[model samples]
Target: MRMLLQIAFIVAAGYGALVAAAYFAQAKLVYFPAVGREQVATPAQMGLPHEELTLRTKDGVRLHAWYVSVPQPRGVVLFLHGNAGNISHRLDSLAMFARLGYATLIVDYRGYGRSGGRPSEEGTYLDALAAWRHLTAERGIAPEDVVLFGESLGAAVAAWLAAQVQPRALVILSGFVSVPELGQEVYPFLPVKWLARFRYATADFLKDVSCPVLVAHSRDDEVVPFRHGERLYAVAPGPKSFLELQGGHNEAFFFVRPEWERSLAEFLDSTRPVR
Candidate 1:
């Protein structure tokens, strides 16, 4: 009996240590700012002319962005990228938007690329607001002419901003309902719901958004799971469209570019402001 008690104590201590580690390292696990931290390429490499922008967040963090403009753009896309790499890695997306006749502005969150300061849930939201203000206030672009496009972790940030600003449309690619919810799904053994300090509550943000929404996801998304997209789409109120793609999490958008672009054009066209 004494030996059994000793074994139970060891097991309890091991579990406690795991929980403590998860709690302390939660930010590092969620934000991958170190992976490909340098800018390797730009829109010019893809034959697209763009202007380099430096935005100052409300909290005084400086962010790096690129504004790629096309002739007579149908609209503007405020692109928020995933957690890993900087804005330089999204040249393909900029080219795609240009093909669709839309100006693209993609920003690197703090701590990624040349941007100053570190990333946190609140900091990302402020970074997004800085980009929005650059377009709507500084550049004098109408709110209705800007489309908020987010991918993976960026989807949550865009959703939060869309709720506040009510842009022309909110587009989410491979998004999630919430960080804690996704954490639970990914780490079933850990008590992620309690350990999570980041609350990118995308579903809750969608409830407050009034603009048209477009959600794209793949059935074979190995990272964030298909159910997250399904739940996000369900939570959106109205005038929303869901584009189901094929392939893995990161590869789905590219693998079906032809089909995906068609759907994207259709959705954006439907939301186009009659001028």
Candidate 2:
């Protein structure tokens, strides 16, 4: 009985240490800007024409972006990527948007790719706002003709921006309700809700967003569970949609491209103003 108690004590101590480590290292776990830092490919490689842009945020951070254009564009997509990799890794998505006759403006958040500064929750929101201003102000794209498309962590940034700017539509792919909520889900054994330093509250922001919303998630997603998407959709206002995707978190968009394109096209059509 003494030996069993000793073993239990050791196990408890180890678990406590793990929770402490997770608490301190939360920022490192949230952002992955260092991964795939090299510029892998460009829009030209995918047979798409693009213009490199350097945007200045309100906080004076200079961000790098790519404006991939399509002829007779149905609309423009301001693509905010996930917490991982740089913009160079998102050429496939740019090409896909181009195929759908939507010009894409994908930006590397601060500290990712060619952009400057370190990654932070507030920094990402500022980075997204810079991209939005570039599209609406510099490029002369009307708010009614602009779509905010965010994946994973970017969904939170996009939703926050959508609430303020009132873009034509907002698309959240593999999104979570909030950082603390997701952390709690991912590390159920730990006190993740209290440990989280960042609060990218996507669902809360969705409540303020008046634009049409599309929440897509994959049941097989190993990273973010499908219920996050369901919850986000439930919280979104009217003219909202929930798309069921297949494959893991990263691969779901690529895996269901054909179906995604079809559904997205239909959804975009519905958002058009009736003459």
Candidate 3:
């Protein structure tokens, strides 16, 4: 009987340790590295003059950003980047939007680049709202002239923002339904829903957003699987579109294939008014 009790105690302790390890490693596992990459392309490389801007959140967290303008600008794209990198890592995306004749404002969330404050789900949402206010209130850009583009974790941030602001259109790339859902998928043994501190519930908020949406995911994506994108696309309201690409998570947009750019351009064109 003593030996049986000892064995039970050992098993319980091991399970407890596993849970603790997963809880502590949650943030680290979710956000990857942003440093040690080559400098991102600049507007000069793309033959454009872009303005650098600093925005302050209501909570006094300052963020770094860039605003690139295009000839006969179709609209403004408020870019919410993925979890791992700062705005510099997304220069290619800005260039793509510029090529499509849309002004792009790419901002780094809290705890990224020169941005202030540590990152949390609510904090990132606040940071996105601050960037939006800077563009609409300070720059005088109307809501109807803005497009929200979010990638990976940024997709959740963008979904929350779209629910509140109702932009001209919304785009989610490599996004997930919620952090808990992602956690459950990665660690099936753990009770993720109970332990998760940051719940970026993009799926829960989709029903509230009334604007047009475009969700893009890659079949080869290993980070956030394509099912998350499909689920988000399925729950979104009318006038929505989905694109399945050939590359992985980060490379999907970077591949620069004709089909990728063509699909994006076609989606953007669909937003225009019929003459």
Candidate 4:
């Protein structure tokens, strides 16, 4: 009987430890100032002049970004990248948007690249807002001239911003419905819905957005399940479109899917402001 009680106690203690670890690990899930090579594409490579930019956040964190200008840019794509890597990791995507006649601004969230500040949900949201302000206030780009393009974790930030700020359109790539939902998916045994600290509840904010939305997800996305993207599209209260492609989390662009580019271009074309 004593041995049985000891075994039960051990099991209970192990379960408690696992729950505690998951709760504390939420903040450590996203790494800032991502490690790896920073790839910058030249005009010849992307068919546009790309300028590196450094902007200051409200809290004085200097964030890194790259602006690529297209000849007759239909609209500007404010590219909020995925959880990992700095802007350099997304040069291919920047080039693709530039080639499709859209000026692109790829900004690094605080703690990513050369940007300062620890990466939390709130911190990333603030970093995105700073990028928006820099383009609109400092560079003279109107809200109507900008499209928010967010990938994975960046999509949550974009959704939150769209709820607050009016933009031409929003694009969510490889995105989840909410951070807590994702946590539950990852740690099915844990009480993620209750324990998650940084709740990037994008689905909750979708109802407040008034602009057109485009959701792109890979059919076989391993990191974020494809259903989350579909669910978000269903909840968004706007003229919305969904594009499903082949590939996994990071390689969705590698297939050079025409639907991916066409959907974005068509959405921008439809939302362009009348002169």
Task: Tell me, by TM-score, which candidate is best.
Answer: 1
Candidate 4: 10-residue stretch with minimal lDDT: 35-44
Q: Over 4 Å off in model 2, which ranges?
A: 1-16
Relative to the true structure, how large is the alpha-carbon lDDT of every model?
A: 0.93, 0.89, 0.84, 0.82
Q: Give per-residue lDDT, candidate 4, residue 54.
A: 89
Per-residue CA lDDT of candidate 3, range 74-166, in tens?
889999988876777776777788888889988888778777677777788999999899889999988888899998899999999999996
Candidates sorted on TM-score, descending? 1, 4, 2, 3
- Per-residue CA lDDT of candidate 1, range 1-275, in tens? 99999999999999999999999999999999999898999899999999999999999999999999999999999999999988988888889999999999899999999999999999999999999999999999999999999999999999999999969999999999999999998999998998889989999999999999999988988998999999999999978999887778767245237877899999999999997
Model 3 spans with C-alpha error above 4 angstroms:
33-41, 252-255, 273-275
Clashes of each: 0, 0, 0, 3
What lDDT is reached at residue 96 by model 2?
78
Tell me the TM-score of each prediction against the true structure.
Answer: 0.98, 0.93, 0.93, 0.93
Model 3, global lDDT: 0.84
lDDT-based ranking: 1, 2, 3, 4
| Model 2 steric clash pairs | none
lDDT of 2 by residue, 133-196 (tens): 9988988988999999999999999999999997889999999999999889877888888888
How far in Å is the alpha carbon of 42 misplaced in model 2?
0.4
Q: Which candidate has the highest lDDT of all?
A: 1
At residue 83, what lDDT does model 1 achieve?
91
Q: Model 4: runs farther than 4 Å from truth?
A: 37-47, 252-255
Compose the digit string of candidate 4's lDDT tens values, residues 16-54: 999999888777775534464254444446455888788
